[model samples]
Target chain A: MSDKRGSRAADRTEAIMRTALELGEEIGYAKLSIEAVATRAGVGKHTVYRRWSSKGALFLDSLLSLNEAHLDYPDTGDVIADLRQQIHAAINLLDRAPVGPLYRALIGEALLNPQVAAALNDHFITPQAEKTVARLKAARDQGQLSPDFDLDLAMGILSGPLYFQALIIQKPLTHEYVDRVIDALFTGMGPRP
Target chain B: MSDKRGSRAADRTEAIMRTALELGEEIGYAKLSIEAVATRAGVGKHTVYRRWSSKGALFLDSLLSLNEAHLDYPDTGDVIADLRQQIHAAINLLDRAPVGPLYRALIGEALLNPQVAAALNDHFITPQAEKTVARLKAARDQGQLSPDFDLDLAMGILSGPLYFQALIIQKPLTHEYVDRVIDALFTGMGPRP
Candidate 1:
């Protein structure tokens, strides 16, 4: 295809994703449909279908497009502080619209749909987890964490609570909550010496 | 109502719940319906609807009926060992058929439906959390944990990782994984003193 054709295709894809997010937040995942998204985006149904096979696929892409920057972990040489900052941002994202509802919906979809689940884990969950693991490894190397710290378990510990609160209990994610989690990890839950 | 009538109603309710579970496991949640459950149970649709308002409600009751024994915390005076045993059993449940798929389907429904979410938190999540909190309190009293250890965070810490693995990453939950999480909690992740 010509450069102009390639540019136009890219634009249409972005438009469809944007419309998916907007419609997702508006009508939620259950009610939103590809046809409606295509109509709103001024694109043909075939164009949307050609790109995304299902609503879950479309929504996952839409959520990732908006969430790329939020997944990065900062390394200011203080692991706990950096984690607190990043988790605070993550919880904040879950506490607000567009991302929060969209994410929850995606999770709902992922649970029921194996295809969506695999795609979500591949594109989103695995990458975010890897970044966090990398940061924790850096901390471990720096002696900020124990050399033998279980990085796999650490990954789950850092993320599991927040996800539990937000997705399972449907509770509000607070900054204080983030601090509490970080403090628990750093201080440890074991009996004092 | 007459005692005989009440007994009959109770028997019918049990049958309905049992059928709901069977149908949920057989056909899965997304495809299972109230009408189908009623038909399978050999009861009128009104009978099913009278007892539970929705499929989620019925499934929640069905799950609780089967899962009540699994949620209890064993106070063997060894908190870590008890937790390890309990988490191992919980993970075992998630790894198998019937309960695993049914619970996953319920979670999927709960995410999209607020009433289901609230009922799940109230009936399942909160009670299980409280049981764990009570166990932790007992441990703290016995000097097994720090007095100031945040039980709420601990509850999340204990269950969150397992749930994250089972529900989010869709990883296989194993006995070794349970031991790793318990060890992490007991040993602490902080830098060596």
Candidate 2:
């Protein structure tokens, strides 16, 4: 393909993805369809199928395109504090419109479809988890966290409650909730010393 | 109503519920329809709908009937040990055939349907959480657990990581994993004293 043709294809792909995200946010995952996305984008349904194989794949792409930066973990010499800040930001993103319902929809899809589950794990869940693990590893090296605890398990422990509340319970997450989780992890929930 | 009719009605109800559970385990929640379940139960579709309004409702009822006793928290006078024991049993139930996949389907349905989500919360999630909380309260009263942390949050902390691994990551839940979680909760994950 010529340079102009390549640029035009890229633009059309972006338009379709943008349309998918919008329809997803508006109608949710259960109702959103590739046909609807194509119609809204003024493209043929075949155009969409030619590019992405399924609705889950399209939505996954659209979600990753826009929301990757918001969840980046920061390091500032305090592991707990950094975790608190990042989790608060994550909860804020996940609790609000677009990302929250979109993510919920994706998770719902992932549960039913193995392909979506594998793709979601590969593109989104694993990468984000690895980022958190890297931060925890740094903290472990600095003696901020015990080397005794499994870092992978620690990652799940840090994240599981937030996902449980946000996704399973469909509750709004609060900064106070983030702090409580961090404190529980740091101070331990055992008897008073 | 006559005694004969009442007994027949009860028998029919049990048959329908048993069929729902079996079919749910066989085909999962997505493809298991009211029509299919009714057909399998040797009842009319309207008969299935008469007792339970939706598939989620039916599955919730079926799940509760068989699995409730397995999750009953033991009060062994040690909160952490009790939690460890109960969680192990719960994981064993959720990790295997029948209950595991059936519960996953219910959760997937819950994510997509508000009515199912509400029903799941009312019937399954909230009740199990309360049982755990009640156990934790006893521990708090006995000075085994610090009175500072929120028991509700504690419940999430206890269960979330396990759910995250089992449901989201699609990983096997092991006894050793349960022990690690309970240990983290009891011993804390912060720097060594």
Candidate 3:
């Protein structure tokens, strides 16, 4: 009986998250609300509040639901290859139609709303950033990267181009562009003479 | 008499722009309006509208007002030094408190508002990108950069770290970070062995 109840609860939670993503993509984060999400999910507002403290929390979950699978931090003993795969995966995730718009909305909301920003940083940004940093540190320890490599700066060097291309310049996130970025950066960070 | 009139008009424009910046800093961009600007500047609403067609245009002008002086493309015949100087100036400009917040707001609005994005691109983004690209092309032609250097890819490599540090990571835009980024990129793009 308990197992059956647990399975049903999990299904409802997934349903609610699915509704939130759809609504968020359609209406945007600024106008997304818990009430609307609950209504769309065919659940009571109390059900959503029981799971999430605020709309930002719900939005964060929605983003994670859509993105968690693609955010693999591969450590294949080749730092360049691992970083390239990780960043390329991220670009693919962000390039999808609703996902791109969804990210833009989340980031836009984060800029204006401190609560949303904190939630996003705490739940989404920090974890991904930390994972990338940890992978770089491992690479450094393995003697694949320079001893002088600053992890934070290196992360910026590796991932910054993709972010710039996707968000600021509004350019297409192509695989060839990704290859060039990785090559340029990897060449620079290779063993110094 | 016409010259006097032109100078007076220019002065009013400056005054209005100054007031807009102050208000934008105080209340944030989402709440900033032409009406507030007109009232703050002690000018008529019609006067504000006569110069700018939309609030986004006014905001773009306000950003340009603060940034135009620093936006000069340095061409000291040294590609590395010129790019470094250019990026350093940009970092300094954005590091200012109001300017950083203003940029975040503009970028946030740009994601949601097409007109704001277009204005930002037309006035600020395109010109700076073009300047950087032109300078790089000139350097390539001068045989300063490797013939294999891709201008578009190089621009992404050069400017990406700054945008990443400022917008996504929310880290301090340190001089050391800028130097390291420039060195890494410059080393990568240097002539082959």
Model-by-model DockQ, in order = 0.75, 0.68, 0.41
Q: Candidate 1, residues A116-166: lDDT per residue as tens digits?
A: 898888777888888989999999989999777888787787888888888
Best by DockQ: 1
Candidate 3, residues B140-161, lDDT tens digits: the string is 7887776666666766787788
Q: Candidate 3, which segments miss by more than 4 Å at Cα?
A: A75-78, A137-144, A189-193, B42-46, B75-78, B138-144, B188-193
* Model 1: per-residue Cα lDDT over B1-193, one tens digit each: 6999999999999999999888887777889899998998899999988878777888888877875787688889999999988877666665678788788878888887898898788778888888888999999999998777898787778878888988999887889988888888767788768
At residue A112, candidate 2 shows an lDDT of: 76
Candidate 3 collision pairs = none
Docking class of 3: acceptable
Compared with the true structure, what per-residue lDDT tens digits does model 2 show for residues A119-174?
78877779888999999899889999877877768767988898788777777788
Residue-wise C-alpha lDDT for candidate 3, range A1-193, written one tens digit per residue:
9999999999999999999989988887778889999998999999999988778788778767876877978889987788778877887887778778888787777777777777877887778878988987887778776566556666677778887787777778988889888776666522334
True contacts kept of each: 0.77, 0.74, 0.41
Please report, as a residue range, the 10-residue window in candidate 3 chain B with the lowest summed lDDT.
Answer: B184-193
Sorted on DockQ, best first, the list reads 1, 2, 3
